[model samples]
Target chain A: MRGDVIALDVGGTRLKGAVLDERGHALTTLERPTRATRTPAAVVESILGALADLRRRPQAEQAVACGLVVPGIVDSVGGRAVWSENLGWRDVPLRELAARRIGLPVVLGHDVRAGALAESRHGAAAGYRNTMFVPIGTGIAAGMVVDGRLLDGDGLAGELGHVSVGHEELCACGAKGCLEAVASAAAILRRYRSRSGAELGGTQEVVSLAAAGDTVAGAVWTEAIDALAAALAMASSLVAPEVVVIGGGLSLAGATLLEPLQSRLDSRLTFQRSPRLLTAALGDRAGCLGAGLLARSAMAETVGVR
Target chain B: MRGDVIALDVGGTRLKGAVLDERGHALTTLERPTRATRTPAAVVESILGALADLRRRPQAEQAVACGLVVPGIVDSVGGRAVWSENLGWRDVPLRELAARRIGLPVVLGHDVRAGALAESRHGAAAGYRNTMFVPIGTGIAAGMVVDGRLLDGDGLAGELGHVSVGHEELCACGAKGCLEAVASAAAILRRYRSRSGAELGGTQEVVSLAAAGDTVAGAVWTEAIDALAAALAMASSLVAPEVVVIGGGLSLAGATLLEPLQSRLDSRLTFQRSPRLLTAALGDRAGCLGAGLLARSAMAETVGVR
Candidate 1:
């Protein structure tokens, strides 16, 4: 762990952190509640605290860089978190702040984009030159990599959740018929609860109920799968990716989701490339791992690799 | 004109040939019937004849390169025409064939993509790093340029026409509710004719009627504009292009199309970048100018620009 780097994946509810070795393997890991209700200053303090804690550990003593991935529209080139409704941070110069506090070069990226990079480098999409990594969590977004480079588009490129699916239902973002409202984990849970009047524990509970032969749950699950297929098919037509890696809580449904989605996407396509649908291998840790990769990339950039 | 090159834009009904000077100004141009019912080999001969005709002109005496642009899926990397339902060709080694016949380096490309390159170089989308060049003609297709380079996704990318817009009308591609079926010039003209019982000459006639306060034509025009906006908005969300250049026959509407498309796309977007919509600058000759650019690119490559 001599060339270890600190990596942090900050989400709305919790922050995942790791002290990653040069090889990108986590030497140690940590987590803390995001305290999203707190001010941006408080969040910065928490981030610094987490970094300092990692630096003090014996395995992380040689940490030379840091990568911070946040949930928002990040201007990676400008090194600013432009906006994040979930975190209540607007135009925060997080990268510069983190670099100053950590005394190291820092890389800032979006959460879903980081996951895409991690998956491309080490997980389900490894070796694929073109890949689409869709994380269907509380929301849906994609990290699209074309010609071996992950696209950031000034942090506005992967807003797949907001793409209209032509449904009548209104999304939380005030957009009608958005893919997120019909297919995201949050959407699925809310729909099941309202439709069946069942107090489901979570998305996991909804999937369980569907597996146990509940008609409402089954219908809801099928609808989510269909929406995802349509969206993915559109993505395929746009990017022509070799593979599509599905990640997030909903992806845990595994074959139940993949089987239908693959066939539906295939059916939608005429001459476009049919993507290989696969579940993400890195799971929730993908962002943390991607942060590590970003840190390594920063190190290389510092020494003038490009 | 020692650096002059021959550029050809082949369509289903006709093939256009131009002898371009070093600066991409056409020295001489000609158009001949495409003979669509002929075999692919016969089509290649027609292209060769056009090249010969251009080459024999005094202004084209120094032609050293060629660029051939055709409609449909094309693998520019492999120099192969993968499949073109328009030209009735499949897996044709077009580039090699053209080069052999013309005795010059030939660059093969898709028509819409060529138009995109031409627009980016000297037309409406000039100076933009990220752009979507969509031509809504007999069929719809997009030529996407990201990070200053046009994407060649194994010839499968940019099939924007085939994307479902949630209409119930079946498209010719065996898919229900495709954007092309509802928004393309052919689709528009057909819809106008069937609805109004008016045998319109072309999309121009439809637009003229709409401008003259024909309610059916106006409705058809509005539907086309809305569908175009939805698809372009989706393209913007995925690629975050700064500009969207509309080309082909429909672009002749100018402000009539751009005004509605811009506002509708703006309404569809949330946090995504709103693209500037503009009519193409090069008109039908965009393909010829793009071919010139491709020829220049080929010459540079031949001299080892890399």
Candidate 2:
């Protein structure tokens, strides 16, 4: 309980690493680009390098275990990265590799789920037992906590992005009408560019244009909110979470995204409990913080106290 | 653990009572009409009368506890029937009333959730840890088992009935486009009558006519199946249950409902896992059986062995 731990959240483009004490307070944090590492082996090497760098920090001198989380289909129990389209990895035994190299016990988990755990325990969703953490970024996914337990239907429980919102837009997943096809950050930018024949660097640009009274941007943004509300209404109908923590890139839109989305979801619901919608408080550091908690748990389990 | 228990399922129209031995097999079953019991007090008397009748049976000689399940909002842990639109009750302490009269401890639960528990434990959803028991009756509701625990989102989880399925139909709950508005057995009958200008005694009559190649009946049935598939596809995306057990009066349609629903749900999915659709095997007795299980658990708790 007195030792520090090393934590890493390996995303598609960057590795967010942290050294944290047993209480989940970060002692030192670091971020490194993984965009240049194109292959699975290169990504693994980058992860090892990041871990080695963190270990060299004075704060991590007594690090007892490491927690590694990655995007895509992760087999948390098996300590394997099953598949990740963005990170370009499949069936990599990440825990074993890191543990053997770093000489510490390791725990593996899904990045989004880890973020959800962090948010539920210490951020916006804290105090709510049934919570949903939905991150709308390059892609959309949800991490749900029901009855104070994270739902892991074999790592397939929270595919909120893929549920259809009654749209005809084709999704990259070879399906039509997926929420991701219409409401994700990338989807919003793509829709805006195609409809207005104007280029925008990111979804925030479209949000700004919409706020500034651009009709085309307004229409695209409205469509995205509508799709998101439909998906959330469906989620509320099914699980009835007490709080929905909107995270990832689009959540940076703050009230611009949440206000209209909340009203729309409220209008759609009748008998189902309306979940309080809030922006994630931990911002982008949630995954790394959660990874630290996972490492702490691993250490506790080893000491037969968890 | 060695004693029998009395179980009662209180519905809007009837009270189904059962005396069960330790193994959950019904030693004796009885049914009584509650159609004349219009007020909450009258309904309570009807329930007590039914319980008295069941207690007179030889199978109830060693009954130790009673499980009472009612329709509508239930506070299971508080042993209260919070509200029932159907039974015209509000904040009734049914468990205390029943326990005092019967001279035994009592457990209370929601009827649909009880049916789900029974189906998951001993019926269609047996052997599957992640299962959804959706009974499409006069009304539609779901009982979900996630990670081997029944989700009690403050008794507000699993309102699959009210989720919109892209229809314009107005539901009894004052909501438009609800799944219950389009897909419940009652909705199917209403749709058939409004479309065909024919009066049907039951939803099964519409099913029979559809099977006999009536175009209007076929259209109504197809619409119901489409709406169900849409709602279920959404459920799969959210919870990713391993199996979805279709119960209630609609399941009597058997392969007619299951075949097209499975195909339609399959067509809606892209990357999410498809849950196997199965019919409820316990028929109308599921609620009664589940109540017995609840009673058994209460007795086990009293013995400090659960």
lDDT, candidate 1, at B228: 89
Candidate 2: tens digits of C-alpha lDDT, residues A92-171? 99889988888888999888889999999999999998999999899999999988888887777888998888878899
* CA lDDT, candidate 2, residue A282: 96
lDDT of 1 at A102: 70
Q: Which structure among the candidates has the greatest lDDT?
A: 2
Docking class of 1: medium
- Candidate 1, residues B1-306, lDDT tens digits: the string is 248889999987888889998788888899989874578878877887887777778987788888999888888888898888777789989899888876778899888888899999899988888888998888999998887877777777798998878888988878887899989999999999889888888888888888999999999999998998888877887889999999888988888889988999999887789999989999889988888888788778778764
